[model samples]
Target: MRVFISGYYGFGNLGDEMLLDALRALLIEYGFRRDELVVLSASPKETEREHALSSFKRGNLLRLFAEIKRGDLLISGPGGLFQDSTGPWSPAFYASHAFLALLKGAKVLIYGQSLGPIKRRVNLLLVRFLLSKASLVVLRDESMSDMVPRNKLLFTPDPAFILSVGEVSGLRDGIGIVFRRWKWDLESLLRVLVKMGFPLTLISFQAEREREDGIRLSKMYGLPFLTPSNWAEALRVLSTFKLVIGMRLHSLIMSAMTFTPFIGISYDPKVRSLCELLKMPFLESPRETFAFSGYIRDIMIKWDRKSEGLKCEVEILREKVRSVFTRSLNLLLGREA
Candidate 1:
């Protein structure tokens, strides 16, 4: 199969990179070779080097159209690609490619998509049209079900939940802290964690502004800083943590994949949603973070007591997510099994 996959690829975001990795693994299991996957990426060269897959500049219309003409299927998403809250132009920009690929006669599958927070009529209209025409639509959470037709949409956990971790070095004796731009006061919380004798490693999942923020915070607090050069490195780093406290979605997801307990700091609904799905404690408001150390202490005691059970729970979630992806792909391929 000649499959053209599109998303926020080529950006140095660990979450989206893991999404692509999971999709590649699933496609390979279905007998699609690496060479058959063509990725539309912002940095095509970097993507080709990293994934060993053919890539084209994401917004290059001629190249995209050429790929669309040759592709048998267009796999879009497993990310928050259709949301406009990130920007006004995002919905139109991301949807245009899928619409064009459909126009070129390739079957389109929207996988693990999180729809809305879309408020504009024109953007909603475009999104509705695209979703209506997609061959299969797999939404990442039940909250997204109201946005699309019940007949076409299937609910699954986030694509990252299906990621399989390889062997990595043993866990280190420290806390892994993942933070993004938020109004929360973290200095007090950091001081409390430090006083408790846990060494800190600040993790940045996005190489853009989040990395810069992590560095600044690390320097200001005298903590060590780590921003993984790629997705694999990120997963490896996550595996070594004793525990993780994160505001970024993928950081928490990686923690779950690595079987490490995490305390989520919600800056977005998606973060809160995932925390709820996992039945974990989260701080919804920034001020509540002042008492975070107490929350961590209580949670860690419970976490240590339930480590084996937690591991099993995460594995069950992984299997469920994998099954959903398998079913979605089969439907797209018109396979009964």
Candidate 2:
């Protein structure tokens, strides 16, 4: 089967990239050959080079339609692709793509997606319509299940949760921070880690302002810094730490994948939800910034001893998440022949 994928891919966001990687891995695991897949990416060259998959630049309607016409299935999402809070156009863009695929007679699988805080009436209607047309809808959490037809929705953990990194036998004794420019006192948090005598490393998952913040923090604190060139590099950096303090959802997800102990600083509900799902401590940004430093200090003291327990918890979820692809494919493709 020819599969065309659509999402927030190829822009150097580690979380989305990892999701795409997981989706490709799922396709391969289910016996799809390399040439049978096509991706709609913002950076086609990077997607092609890094993923070894055929990619067409996003927003080219002609290309999108042509791909839809040629493909047997069009899979969109595994991200917050249906939300309007980001912008009015964000929901419209993703929903329209799924709509187009349906119009072209391609089976649509909305995979590993987090849908809505969609308060806007028009966007909700659009999402409802688009999802109604989908052959399968796999959600990352249970909250969105009511929004879709009961038969169409399946609740699964984030696809990235299925991503695996083996345990590091001698994990370095230090704290790793995934930094982003959020409305929180990051410097104070860094100072607290330093005062606690944990050597610091700042990791950036995006090429945007977050990378700039990571570099700035590294320089100011005289510590190591990394803006991972790819997901493998990101996973490698994450595996080295005894504890990971992360603001990005995927950073925390990677922590879980590597079985690294973590504390999430939630700037978004997605982070908070994942933290809650993993039973990890998280502080809301700005609201909890003042107490975050002390919280980190306390967690860091016992983090090493606590990691195995955390790993066990995450592994349980990992198995369930890995099953999403198989279940989805069996449902979506099994009906074909």
For all candidates in order, the CA lDDT equals 0.80, 0.81
**Number of clashes recorded per candidate:** 0, 0
**TM-score for each candidate, following the candidate numbering:** 0.92, 0.91
lDDT per residue (tens digit) for residues 1-337 in model 1: 6898989999888888888988898888778888889999999998898888899988986777766773388888878888787789988888878888888988899887778778788998888888889878888766556668888888888877766688844655678988766677767667778888888898888868776777778888899989888777887998887788987888888877777778888866777888888776788876675567777787667766545555777788888887887788778777864
Looking at candidate 1, the ten consecutive residues that score lowest on lDDT are 303-312
Q: Residues 1-337, candidate 2: write the lDDT tens digits.
A: 6898899998888889888888898889889998999889999999999889999887876777876773488899878888876678888888777878888988999988888868789988888888887998888876556879988888888887766675554646688888876677888777777777878888888867576676677789999988888777888888888889998888998887777888998777778888888878897755565576666766677776667776787788778876767878888867433
Worst 10 residues of 2 by lDDT: 164-173
Choose the strongest candidate by lDDT. 2
Winning model by TM-score: 1
State residue 222's C-alpha deviation in candidate 1, in Å. Answer: 1.1
Q: Per-candidate RMSD vs. true structure?
A: 2.2, 2.4
